[model samples]
Each structure stands twice: as C-alpha cells, then as structure tokens.
Target: MRIVVPIKDNSGLESEVCEHFGRARYFVFIDVEDGKVKGSEVIEVPFKEHEPGDLPAFIKEHGGEVVLAYGMGRRAIAYFNTMGIEAITGASGRVKDLVEALLKGALKVDPEWRSKGDFGRHEF
Candidate 1:
C-alpha cells in the first residue's frame, strides 16, 4: 500500500507531520509491503494555490491509498472518501515513527476538530 503523509519539511523520515494537509511544504509517499516500508519519495505540493479538492486529487494521481494528516475538514474527508482514499488525521511526530506505528496497527486516527473548511489562498 502507498501512504501519503503531509510533512513540514523534506527531512526524509525525520520530518514532522505538518499541521495542515493542504498547505504542507512537502508530501511523502511511502511504499509499504507486508506492513513494512519498502521505499519512499517526497515532493512539493503541486499548486501554490489550493482549490477545495486539489490536494486530494494530486495525492490520488500519485498513487496514494491513504493520507496521514494533522487536521482535515469534513469536505476534504468526504472528497478523499469519494476518491477511495482513507484520510487519517490528527497525526504528528516523525514520519518514520508514524509509519512504524501504522505497521504495528498502533497509529490510531485521532479525532479532528470541526472545521469550516474555509482555507484562504496559500503559497507553497
């Protein structure tokens, strides 16, 4: 499975999870096999300006099956579900540690604070 994690920096696995998914500086795509991470890649969020569903669509286009985020709104979650992607929110800590927790089935999807789903234009 391919898991896409939103991060604050391009510090490889040591990168901390960003607070916002749509505005993260970088996105890490981790390839997992038998619950073990086989490989990974990081890329900048494609658009400096985000539309309602652009971020999720970009992740899906890059073969993401799941998304790990710190916070997401109802609309974003619904969009991800519609695209057959799982959105796991309220995440933090190093990316690798998060992945390890996931492998052990310990990375629980923390509850998200309700959002108005109103994000103004953001830059990369």
Candidate 2:
C-alpha cells in the first residue's frame, strides 16, 4: 500500500506530520508491503498556488492510496474519496510511527474532529 503523509520537512521517516494538509511543506510517500514499510520518499508540494481541490488530484497523480494528515478540510477529503483515496485525518507525530500504528490497526481518527477551516489554516 502507498500511504502519503503531509510533513513539515524533508526528514523522511523522521519527518514530523504537518498540522495542515494543504499547506504542508513536504509530503512523505511510504510504501508498505507485508505489513512492513519497504521504503519512503519525501517531495515538495509541486504548485506555487492551488485551489480547494488541487492537492487531492496531485496526490492521486502520484499514486497515493491513502492520505494520512493532521488536518484537512471536508472538501478536500471529499475529493480524495471521489478519487478512491482514503483520507485519514487527525494524525500527528513522526511519519514512520504513524504508518506503523496504522499497519498495526492502532491509529485512531476521530470523525467528529473536522478541520476548523480551509486554505491552509486549520484550528486545533
């Protein structure tokens, strides 16, 4: 499975998950198979400016099967869903750790915790 996580930097597996999905500086792509992470890569968000639905398509283009992030607006999540990508929000901590927890079926996402707003500024 290919899991994409919005991160704050280019630290690979050690990268901290970004608070806001659309505004994240980098995205970590984790490849997992047999319940183990095969490898990962970090890349910068490609566009200088984007609209509400752009990032989801970008993720899809890059073959993202799931999006693990701290916060993401409803519209973006809907877009991801339409594209068949699972948008798992309310995630935090190190990128690798989150992936591990997810694989272990321990990652919990509170559906009630919707992102406060959009355009890269989300309330906690």
Candidate 3:
C-alpha cells in the first residue's frame, strides 16, 4: 500500500508533520507491504499554491491509497472520500513515527474531527 504524509522536510522522516495540508511544502509518499516500508519519495507540490482538490488529484496520480495529514479542510476530506481513498487527519509527530504507528494499528483516526466542517469556520 502507498501512504502519503505531509511533511515539513525530507530529513529522514524525523521532522514534525505539517500542520496544514493545503500549505504543506512537500508530501512524502511511502510504499509499504506487509507492514514494511518498501520505498519512498518526496513529491513537490506544483505551482507554489494549490487548492485542496488539486493536491488530492496529484496524490491519486501517484498511486496513493491513504493520506496522513495534520489538519485538512472539509472540502478536501470529502474529495478524498469520494475518490475512495482513506484520509487520516489531526496527525502530529514525525512522519516516520506516524507511519509506524499506522502500520502497527496504534494510530486511530478521530472521526468526529474528520466529519467536522471548515476547520471549525463554516458548515459543510
């Protein structure tokens, strides 16, 4: 399976995960199989600035099966769901640590947060 994690830097996955999905500078795509990291790469977001849907579509093109983000807007979350890709938000800590937690089933997605709209700004 392929998982994408929004990262602040590509420094061996030890840096903190990005807090905002739309504003993340890079996304580290990791390929895993049987709870093991097979391969990975950092995909740069094009155009310096992008809409949420655009990033999701870029992820789709890269064979992403899941997304591990810190926080994301409701519209982007809905778009990911419509694409049948799993999105786990409200994540923090290092990218590699989060990935390990997910592989070990130690991480839990907060559905309440995911279902909320507009990062608590507007209603969906």
Candidate 4:
C-alpha cells in the first residue's frame, strides 16, 4: 500500500508530522508490503503557493492511496474520498510510529473533530 504523510522536514521517518495537511513542508510517501515498510520517498511542494484542491491533485498524481494528516477540513476529506484515496486525521507523531500504528490498525479517528469542526472550518 502507498501512504502519503505530510511532514515538517526531510528527516525521513524521523520527520515530525505537520499540523496541517496542505501547509506541510514536505510529503513523505511510504510503501508497505506484508505489514512492513518497503521504502519511502519525499515530495517537496512546488514553489508556487497552494490553491484549493492543488495538494490533493498533487497527491493523486503520486500514487497515494491513503493520507495521514494532523487535522483536515471536511471538504478536503471528501475531496480525497472522491479520488478513491482515504484520509485519516488526528494523526501526530514521528512518521515511523504513525505508520506502524496505522499498519496495526491502532490509529483512532475522533469523529467530533472531523466533519464541520476541524482546523479549517472556522468562519469567524
């Protein structure tokens, strides 16, 4: 399986997961087979600032089947789903630990913060 995780640096599995998906400094793509990691690659977002739906499109082009993010808005989640890619939020940790937990089915999804109440949904 190919999983895309947005992180703060180029530290490979040691990179800290970024707090916002689209705002992450780098995207680490990890490949897993038989419950073990095969390898990982990094994607640096282009120099141009992001626009709506840009990152999602970039992820789709990179063979990403799933996304592990800190917190994402409902629209972004739905956008990924439409592309047949799964989005899991409320994830935070070093890249390796989070990947292990995900492979073990141990990452929890907090529904209260998922839909309309996440980091980007504020209208104030």
Error of 1 at 58 (Å): 0.2
lDDT of 3 by residue, 4-72 (tens): 988887664666777777777778999999899988888777657665588789889989999998778
Please give the ranking of all candidate structures by lDDT, highest first, separated by commas.
Answer: 2, 1, 4, 3
- Global Cα RMSD, each model: 2.5, 2.8, 3.9, 3.2
Candidate 2 residue lDDT tens string, 38-122: 9888888887677878888888888899999977877898899899999998888988889999999999765545645453443
Cα misplacement distance, residue 8 of candidate 4 (Å): 0.9
Worst 10 residues of 1 by lDDT: 112-121
lDDT of 4 by residue, 1-124 (tens): 8999989888878898877786776899999999999999998876447666677889999999999988776677888989999998888888999999899988765555454334663221
The TM-score measured for candidate 2 stands at: 0.89
- Give candidate 4 regions above 4 Å deviation: 109-118, 121-124
Instruction: Write candidate 1's Cα lDDT for 1-124 as tens digits.
Output: 9999989999868899987776787999999998789999998876778878888888999999988887776677899999999988777788999999988989865564335233333444
Off by over 4 Å in 2: 110-112, 115-124
Q: List residue ranges in candidate 1 displaced over 4 A.
A: 112-124
Best by lDDT: 2
> TM-scores, in order shown?
0.88, 0.89, 0.84, 0.86
Whole-model Cα lDDT of every candidate shown, in order: 0.82, 0.84, 0.79, 0.82
Whole-structure CA lDDT of model 4: 0.82
